[model samples]
Target: MLSLLATLWLAAAPTKDAEPPVPRPPPPECLSSQGRTVCGYQCRSTGTHADCARTPYGVCQVLTGRVHCWDPPRVVIHHPPRSSARPECKESRGNVACGYNCRLSQGEVACNSTPYGVCSTHFGRLVCWDPPESVIHQYGARTPQPRCLNASEAVACGYDCKAQRAEVQCASTPDGVCRLDNQRFTCFDPPSLLHCDHSAPPPAD
Candidate 1:
């Protein structure tokens, strides 16, 4: 009709101002199960909600903060603080004595009824005294002191109240007790400054 109204007035004349599609900031609402998105808020996956975050272009965010650490809520434990200290009694005793009692020379091994005591000083060093004093006393290589005795016969009388020593020097088998400064005289066989012979025999092959 007049060229169709000049092609509809040049297609309604208005083709050079393009720029009206800016609506894409709506994908970050209430998410917190660690999918992230709830900062300025913008989640709309149609709203089924559960910490959403599906964005690859389809968008469905909701997380916030540290990406909003996932689905937690069930923990209540608290118990750690117990120790007042107090539990002794492992069979202790003290008041011991005698570190020597040769019996006469070394004669007393009948069947060993408990009288060969030797807590130290090296050699057979016996230790047997419990009941009405089954007797076998002579153990004092010296090394006691911890204290707390009621009398297991002062631990069979070798005197080791933990052994800090304030008195324990009672001896008398063939007679032998004095070392707290009696100078020196431990009795019996003792007298070999140096002697060795091994029966002689060995000159190489």
Candidate 2:
């Protein structure tokens, strides 16, 4: 029967399996800086913190501040600002401070370092949160005003904290505002600067 109908037409011929695709991951990996602009995939930035994780439980997220991680868990790599550490400056006019015990009155300027680098300031700007232990904070969106910059242990001698990425939202209690850790945003207290809306998608309410 013509070789039994050519073995049933090669077993009813309908086999097309030679698959070898499914590999296209090489885009996202951006890193702007202070102002903000973040992509994804194994990225890295340290103006304060920006890591796009590449494994090791990767999965980071910082909306307003701008940062996008993927897959697994988290990532944080921020160095610098450790020359034995200790900066407690005050007196502002747009001086801007970091860490230590920096504080300016009326105009606002708070300080703190590590143990959750909590800093604060209001009306004029300046905000920070649980940075330093997997840093984050320095968020953007409406983040402007950053003329005089100094660092050491968290301080806003002048301004430009704007919640950044640390995300404390005050309430840790210096008065616990920003909550937990070391707490210290002196200058008469009240007004830790953490309103809302800066950028990305989750800055609405």
Candidate 3:
């Protein structure tokens, strides 16, 4: 009976529950060429294999053997044409004059209005000038002006002027005037002398 009791006691004793073994993570796979290690489902080298990262908008796939991040879908926007008043244009003397706002002269488009002043292609985009005065005054009498300069003198009335050691160089134009390099005096009409002292200083104020 004691033996039977001992067996019963052994059976009745409470058994401690055995703890479950912790899961071991798999070893990381190293990509020798890219020098990166990846584990599980992450990007791993399959020898020139391409992979992609998924996102809500789009998937970014590997390009040129490089891993790219998630990318969104591209959106294209269309713009309407710019609106402006139709230019009043006319052809005259092989040039197209487009109202007072712009003109097409010598195969170039020129606009005249700007915040600072009027603009013309002849002066380039950087050059601007005040608008011409609307009023005109007539003088009682006009005088004939000369166009030539003295020897060895430089004058730049309309264009560039340079004076060398023995000669004076002036730009030739039909409506050009003569003014010394010093800018002391301006000859609206051409001067009689084409040569003058280019080195002369400005006259007294």
Candidate 4:
């Protein structure tokens, strides 16, 4: 009877309590609309609360709580300046000439045309001439005067001629040989006697 009483007391004792189960989070949802698909949403705080949606190409931002998707901004390109449009020019003799054209301004003469000859300024004036005319135009006043010696037997002139008593002659052909023939002093050539006397005759007899 005492053993039976002990068994009843053991059965009456309370059992231990079971622990509670842990809570689980939900899976991410992939939403699809029209032809585009968005995976998840992102939040941005710039002094104000805004939300962004992630897409395959770019992102969609919410302005004033309004959602809008957009592509990246376009890139801009710039080009440098060109140098072939204008030509080089120069100024001279109070004249302005460029390329093949020349003009005068304010009492100044400019020449660029060279179809006849080379363009140049002479005595403050623009002139174009051939080889002979250019030489005369350039050194006409600077050239030395020629003196001729005349006598009964012979006559001589130019830098190479020498006068001795009654006869005057030139030593070398290059010195311009002048001979008094038939009362006329005929020079072979003034500077050089290698060529024929094609030059104009002297003024004095």
Strongest candidate by lDDT: 2
What is the lDDT, from 0 to 100, of the residue 172 in candidate 1? 32
**Candidate 2 TM-score, C-alpha based:** 0.21
Error of 2 at 151 (Å): 46
Q: Candidate 2's residue-wise lDDT over 150-180, tens digit each?
A: 3343333222322323332222223222323
Tell me the lDDT of model 3 at 4.
Answer: 100
Give the top-scoring candidate (TM-score). Answer: 2
The RMSD of every model to the true structure, in order and in angstroms, is 38.0, 18.0, 33.5, 43.6
For candidate 1, what's the RMSD?
38.0
Candidate 1 lDDT by residue in tens digits, 132-166: 12111122111122112222233323332222233
TM-scores of all predicted structures? 0.13, 0.21, 0.21, 0.18
lDDT of 3 by residue, 1-205 (tens): 9999999999999999998555343332333434544322224344555343232222233333444333221110011012232223334344333222444555554432211123334222222232211100010011111122223333222223334454444433333444555634343423333322222222111
Clashing residue pairs, candidate 4? Answer: none
Sort the candidates on lDDT, descending order: 2, 4, 3, 1
C-alpha lDDT (0 to 100) for residue 14 of candidate 2: 96
**Runs in model 1 with CA error above 4 Å?**
1-152, 155-192, 200-205
Where's the lowest-lDDT run of ten residues in candidate 4?
Answer: 72-81
Question: Would you list the C-alpha lDDT of every candidate in the order shown?
Answer: 0.27, 0.40, 0.32, 0.35
Per-residue error (Å), model 1, residue 38: 81
Which wins on TM-score, candidate 1 or candidate 2? Answer: 2
